[model samples]
Target chain A: MDKNKSINQSANKNESQSENQSRYIGVNEWKRHGFQALWALVTNSYLLGFIQGKIYKGRLKNLCVPGLNCYSCPGAVGACPIGAIQAVVGSWNFKIAFYAAGFLVFIGALMGRFVCGFLCPFGLIQDLLHKIPFPKKLQTFRGDKALRKLKYMILAVFVILLPMFVVDILGQGAPYFCKFICPAGTLEGGLPLVLLNKSMRGAIGWLYAWKNAVLLATIFLSILIYRPFCKYICPLGAVYSVFNPISVFRYRVDKESCVDCGVCAKVCKMQVNPVEHANHPECIRCGACKKACPVNAIR
Target chain B: MSRVFRSRRIGILLMAAGLILMGFGIHRGEMAVVFGKAVNICMECIGIG
Candidate 1:
């Protein structure tokens, strides 16, 4: 009788412990989502632009937001960092994008990829898409490590190199990443403006079709995987990731408290082993590992 | 220096550098350049033109 009573108590304790852990994770997720939504709304607050089908042309547009928000987004009051960089680099007069580069350095030093985790509108979209209750969600796959490096290449070739070297007759270069890639631009800027403006509808051609295809692929892939764009394609994410290790706000694993249970690794959507790589460039600092750590080791 | 203090120092230095760079850019009228690009609808960004 005593044995059975003890067994029941132990079972109850285990259940309560799991409930507590899940509650902690839930709170963190809510906080992150709230912050992301607030930032998105704050940055893209020009509601009249959406209704009137015009881009915001306020003085605030000179400032670059930390995430991959499109400057051409109908409601965006601030410019995108990547877009701003490409613009200055591609200009006939400027070889260096000092303003945009400064903004990136400031944000990266302050929070690293924490912007990706808790500020980016597109990141919030991916998080929502990933929560659609799909079966067989893939956390990692073949060539995942190799594929992760693709974002850096895109940053180098499309955002920086092509925009710097490739020029038109007037000696001005094109925003290659914005023109050829960037699903955010398509979803936020292209579709809305085209839908609202009949003239823009007539202007739609092969390029718009190509961008739509890319956007479709991103949307579907986001449903299957966690942040496929951030992990594989986003140049902004690539830039911020470089600062993750030394950023002011970063993860630190407490050696004395960690027990090697591997729970944090299992819960991490980014596939980062926080115990081994506390501030891994891949880690978005989403707080999943910290919340999942049984001994409260990660901070 | 300890790891935390070292990380904080680096972050502060980077922040200062970024501020200085931004100030220089502003002095050079790069803000106006950025404004010129951002105020207009970027056809390239929308994958048009």
Candidate 2:
């Protein structure tokens, strides 16, 4: 870590351009490439299951990656959370999946936005796009603490409750977040499937139009905000926050050497306090804040 | 950390191996989607080709 700080001393690592230009290896580089790689997965058949469907669609097979990936994505090789939840709810299925719950807890405990920062291909796309040169507004760090609470409520209500308790006697479950929300699904999942299969495209109507509008709005809004969906929405981030305190790999702060000098906070993409939630769940482990600290107070 | 990397090496290799096996399973008499069809919709759809 010291060696890295020394090398980047003359070079500001915080700039998205510098980071892009710098030859960073390890997990983070994989993230930049992984976002593209999933697209490669769509092209090549390397990890088709993540884009297509999983090996088994059994009762207990839903414990998996959190963010929305299209189960119908031609190259997908795993089960998507929204799809799994829908499958579970549709079947009016067994006990709440202990494995699924545990997986979410485990991810939250580990890197908070590590999933967002690295693992999630969709989140990576937004991060890459945000790097595109443009002036944008950062959220109100001081004034909007209350509204920031909306994400958690969204996690609870839209992501969890509606799917779990709102099942009808007909035993049908809705992909609440995907059907009604989830811009990732709208853009990545829904549109592609429609375009690829003409039948699905021809059948499109009010629902498709509505989702497209949300997708267009989100894409437009993404240019104005760093990550509009990720900042105020994305229930997965809320769930991951639950495990922030004890996550396996997370930020730690050194208070003694520290001035409460807020360089770290200002550059923070997620607007989380590196001092407060050192391993903050909202933090996507983007490394932006760590690189921002002038005194190297954070690690 | 070296130990961590060593273990990760094994784990990644294992994952690679499994993905390879899965690739093999998915590869019976299949022709690659000629890059032409893939490239056309690559950027807007999946963000890469």
Candidate 3:
């Protein structure tokens, strides 16, 4: 009788602990979502620009917003870092984009992909899309690891090399990523402008059609997968991931407390093993691992 | 040095380097270049071409 009572008591204790942990995780998730929505609004806060169907033309536009926001977005108060870098590199003058590069380095060193987790408007969009009830959510698939490396290639070829090499008759190059790929540009800039101004609607052509297709695909894929763009396509995420290991705001696992339960790995949507690789490049620092740690091993 | 300390030191150094590079870019009028491009509604850049 004593043995049975003790076993039931232990089981009850475990159940209560699990319930508390889930409640804590829920609170953290809500807090993160709130912060993300607030940051998106703050960055894209030029309400007048949206109403007028005009881009912000202030000196603040000189500064980059450390995310993949489109500067051409009607409500954007600041420039996109990737677009700013391409402009400098693709310019006929062919000078280094020191300000843009410096801004990236500083932000990366400070927070790494925390910007992806909490600040990016596009990241927030993907997060919200992924929340829509779906029949199947794929955490990983075939070629996932291999596909993750493609963003680095995109960064090199489209953002850097193509702009530096491929020039027009006037020795000017184009922002190829924004021109051909960036769904954020199409969704945030192209769609709104076209809807608001009849002149912009007339200007839409094959290229606009292609951009719209890409945006639609991104939206569709985001419903099934978590941060498909950040995982496989964002050049800015590539830049920030490089700094994840050494960034000031990085993850640290407490060796003494960790019990090798593998809970963190199972909880991590980014597929990072927090116990083994707390500061993995793919970690957006989403705190899922930390929240799911039964022993509070991750910090 | 301990790992944490070393990481912190490297971050601080990188931050300083970034600030210096930004100041140099400002000195060389790159801010104006970014501002000029940003303020304009480049329809081609957004794929309305």
Q: Which is the leading candidate under DockQ?
A: 1
10 residues in a row with least lDDT, candidate 3 chain A:
A19-28
Model 2 spans > 4 angstroms off: A1-63, A141-143, B1-49
Model 1, span A1-299: residue lDDT tens: 99999999888876766665465444248778988999999999998999999999888998989888998899999999899989889988887888888889889988899999988999999988888778889989999999999999999999999999999988789999999999999998999999999999999899999999999999999999999999999999999999898788888899998866667776888999898999899999888888878789998
- Clash pairs detected, candidate 3: none
Query: How close is every model to the real structure, measured as TM-score?
Result: 0.91, 0.67, 0.91
Docking class of 2: incorrect
Residue-by-residue lDDT tens digits, candidate 2, A19-44: 43242222134445556556435432
lDDT of 2 by residue, B1-49 (tens): 8865653453344334434533442242111111111212222222221
Q: What is the lDDT of residue B15 in candidate 1?
A: 77
Report the number of clashing residue pairs per model: 0, 15, 0
Evaluate residue A199 in candidate 1 and report its C-alpha lDDT on the 0 to 100 scale. Answer: 92
DockQ-based ranking: 1, 3, 2
- Report the lDDT of model 2 for residue A115: 68
Which number leads on lDDT?
1
Which stretches in model 1 have alpha-carbon errors above 4 Å?
A: A1-28, B1-3
The better candidate by lDDT, 1 or 2, is: 1
Better by DockQ, candidate 2 or 1: 1
